[model samples]
Target chain A: MALIELRGVSKIYHLGGEEIRALDNVDLDINPGEFISIIGPSGSGKSTLMHILGCLDSPSKGSIKLDGMEIGSASARELARIRNQKIGFVFQFFNLLPKLNVLQNVELPMVYAGCSSRERRERAMDALRLVEMDNRAKHRPMQLSGGQQQRAAIARALVNSPKIVFADEPTGNLDSHTGETILKLFHDLSLKGSTIALVTHDPEIAAVTPRKIEIRDGKISKNVDAKLSGQHDGPKFAVGSQQN
Target chain B: MSLLNAILVGLREIWAHKFRSLLTMLGIILGVSSLIAMSAIVKGMEHGMKEAMIALGGLDKVLTREAPVPTWQSHLSDQARGRTMRDVEALQRSAPLIRMVSPEMALERVTISRGDKRTRPSEFVGVWPVVIEMNLHNLEHGRFFNDVDEANAHAVIVIGTAIRDDLFGSPEQLGREVIPIGERVQINGQTFTIVGMFEHYESDQDRKKREWAREHPDEAAQKQAVARGRPGYGGGGSRSGWAFDRKNRTVYCPMNTMWLRFRAASGTGNVPDPTLTDIDFKVEDLSQMEDALQQAKNVLLTTHNGIEDFSFSTQEGNIESVDQAIRNARMSGGIISAISLLVGGIGIMNIMLASITERVREIGIRKAIGATFLDVFTQILVEAVVIAIIGGLAGLVAANLLVRFLASLSPTGNTPIVTFEAMAMAFGFSVAIGVLAGLFPAFKAAKLNPIQALRYE
Candidate 1:
């Protein structure tokens, strides 16, 4: 059975007296250790789909089952528990708490999970080390470069040991070199059997991932083949190589 | 997360916005300090008033004096006279609630001496042994005259604070047991032994005298020398109308002792040896003062053949008027200060609301990371309370210092009594205000939609 299953999920939004279908009868399934990219234009409702899939927002209709538990109708607390223990999210804005140093930001999830201080500190350090951010552990988000900030944010997402990771334009604010480094980090985690979902508006960004799901006008345009051929083009690239 | 972590976060947030936090706490600080200061001032006022009452004997005492003759009368009649010893005897017989009636007599400008240490001529009081108890003069050392001393016409006296300093050379001697009982002194060329000393009851006049003495020690010494050279120059200044003030410089001897040694031996023509001034009446119980006063007045009028010559003054009535004034003062002060506390609580509420608005995204992020609504609510509530408590504790410290400084400046040198209950009350008020003020803001923060909040700019 798939690790995550979405059945006929539909979402409608009312904005200024106009009915807009943000997600129309979307059905999808994600297997364990799958590295998938969701691609769409600006108004394609890809972010809304990611929000629903991550359980940050509930689906307006249809059932979502993760690990055999239906989540579409779950209570707020249950959704919060699923977010904390099962899924990790990295946003376009990084979303690191600015007042916190890198290490404390990474420790935030375990803090809500009620982990002991010693264990939290150890796990946070290990996560930062994995993202090559342990040296900047004491630096606040504002003190870091854009790439370093995203690295710290990724460290935070991975620190909880979630079953799946979601990146919504994780490289949107970074230089191409830094963006490739972050993508390579995601690839390494996926290769290590961690389920990954990468959301982007650029087809080239989606081309690097093993699988791609394309969205258009609030509906799924394509559920591509299991593997996109010739996408593992090494973790590093020459500077300024990729563009819109 | 545990409550401790939440508290630490709150504290850190406060510290991050130091000026804003201080401004938020200002209202609470002012409210708490004013409350404490007002209580202290009221307490000091009560202490001063109570001491004054004690000096006037007590609420159960009454003073009866001869009333002036009717102003409508055109002709002067020699038959109408002031109260006499006979009237005192009549009251003693007529009023069962009257415990004792003591007579007050004064010998103006009499020299008092002990070896070389003599007070310049001051008033000399002649009173019965019961006069000491009736007047409520606190004895600092030795003892009051007893029936044995009065009966024997013993040359024994209890000096007042002023005279104690004058004759003994130091007021500190009174408290140190330096002036032993049976120590000899002389009053009006007659020898007397010091039997007791009166504790100094402070008044505005007393404070002035002390301040004067402190500023002009040499001048005071020269004046004492000049008064010593002349016999009648330094008596309890006849201008000091208080009987206690006069007594301070005057010598107190048993009424019989004054009659036997000075009145009988001297050639000065005056009323009979046992002639009286105003008589002091002590009721058996405080509640019986009104009845006691009326009965004594009736007896005095009857004894004088219905002349209605004497007027009565009850300590109970005097104290009630004074107490009413104190209560009025306290109520006004309390109301004004309580308003300050209310303003402080409102300030807390305002600041908490602003904080919720400023941290909307933070709240969303925490919720996104699995913080329950209850968790977010408690966190904000903790932040508000911490601010209140900090402000309250600061107010307490400031109030205490202010109270001490004000007491030091006061003539009576009385400070506010900082009761444990008052501290706890002030602290508890701040905490309650924290919770109340934080409630709406915390609720608003907790109810924010995670998706909307994360998207908030």
Candidate 2:
């Protein structure tokens, strides 16, 4: 069975008496250890789909399941629990809390997960180490470079040991070189059997992922499985080494 | 998240916006501090007024006398009768609440002399020994004449400190045989032994009156020199139709001794001159003062054959007026302080709303990180309460300091008392304001949609 399944999901918003369909009849499934990208231009409902999948929002109409639990039918408390235990999100602007240092920011999800402070500290440090941000753990978000901030955000996402990580334009604020470095980190994570759903408007960014779901006009227009194209980067990194 | 984490977050938000937080706290601080200040002031005023009332013989001292009827009206109505020793005895027997009746007859402008030392005639007050306590006078030396002295009409006197100094040398000569106890002094050609000396009791109002009189000696003496049969006594302007002249310079003797020795010089020279100038009735309990006064009045009326010649007056009436004024002041101060607190709560709410708006994105980020509505609500509410509490504490400290400073400057020796109850009340009110003021803003923040919040700038 797929780790996540979405069928006939739709989201409609009303603006000044006009009905705008942000997402229309989207059907999708994500397997464990998959590296996938949802690609679309601005206003293509890609961000809305990411919000629904991350459980930050519920579909206006849909049957959505995560880790065998229904997403759309879950209570707000349950959604929060799923978000804390089952999924992690990295946003476009490197959404690190400005007041907290890198280490405290990384420990946020674990804090929600009710992890003991000692365990949270150890796990957050390990996550920071995975993203090469451990040395800057004491620094606030604004003190770091755009790439460094995103690295800390990724550490925060991985701190909870979520089964699926969603990156919504994760490198949108970074230069190409930093963006490429972040993509390589995602690739390393995916190769190590950590499922990643990377959302981006850039086609080149989408091309690097093994699978792509291209969205247009609030609907999925094309789906591609490119496992063979990305085969050379697989099995190069140790699996579960960071987790253990 | 734990409560500590939420508190830490709230603290950080306040620290991040220092100026805005202080401005928001201004209302609570002002409210709570003023509450403390007002309480202290009112308490101090109450203490001062009570002291003043007690100094003026207090609510338990009632004076009764014949109602003044003009000579022309005296014939039309029953002749105005005087309050006498018989009437005093009658009230004592009839009024259960009347503890003691001190009848006073005065011998004014009589010469007092001992050996070569002599002073101008001061009024001599003849009363029972209980008048010492009833009039709140303290004996400086020896003892007041007791029942034996009154019943036997012994020619013994307790001179005021001023008269002691005049008849002898200065106060240091007191024990050195100058105006010594058991030594004789002459009042209106009659010799009396000095039995005691009373310490001067004067209030601030009395002191001010004395100061004014000293400043205008000629006018004061002229106004007071009238040989009116009853001298104006209690030194303040006549309010209750009588004045108790300063007791500091007068002589006190047994009523029988005064009447026997100085009756010719004291009253209208009529045989069987049974007129008593004033009667001092000490009620057993202050709570029953009105009833005691009424009962005494009935006794006097029936004894006088329903002539209604005597009128009753209590120092308690004066205390009531003072109490009413103090109560009004306290109520107004409380209302003003309450307004300040209310304004402070509103200010806190306004600031909290603004804080929520400014941190919409932050709220979104927290929400996305598995923070439920409860978490968000608690964080905002905690921030508001924290601000209010901090302000409240600051106000408490400020009010105490201000009260102490004001007390130090008071000339009347009125020290504002900051009771524990006042501090606790102010602090509790501040916290309540914080919670109440923070509620709506916290609710607004909690109700925010995570998606919409993240989208907000």
Predicted model with the maximum lDDT: 2
Candidate 2 residues B103-142, lDDT tens each? 8887667778888888863567788877877777888778
Model 1, A77-106: lDDT tens digits are: 889899999899888889899988999999
Predicted complex 1: CAPRI docking category: medium
Q: Which digits, one per residue and each the tens of the lDDT, describe model 1 over residues B316-423?
A: 666788789888977898788778888888898889898889888888888877787888899999999999999999989988987888877874555567666667
Residue-by-residue lDDT tens digits, candidate 2, A1-244: 8999999999999999999999999999999999999999999999999999999988999899898888798888788888888888898888898989999999988877778889999999999999998999899998999999999999988888898999999878887777878988999888788999999999888877878999999999998887655453432323334432
TM-score of each: 0.71, 0.77
lDDT of 2 at A16: 100
Worst 10 residues of 2 chain B by lDDT: B235-244
lDDT of each: 0.81, 0.84
Q: After superposition, how far is residue B334 of candidate 2 from its true place, in Å?
A: 1.4
List candidate 2 stretches off by more than 4 Å. A228-244, B59-126, B139-143, B146-148, B156-202, B206-251, B255-320
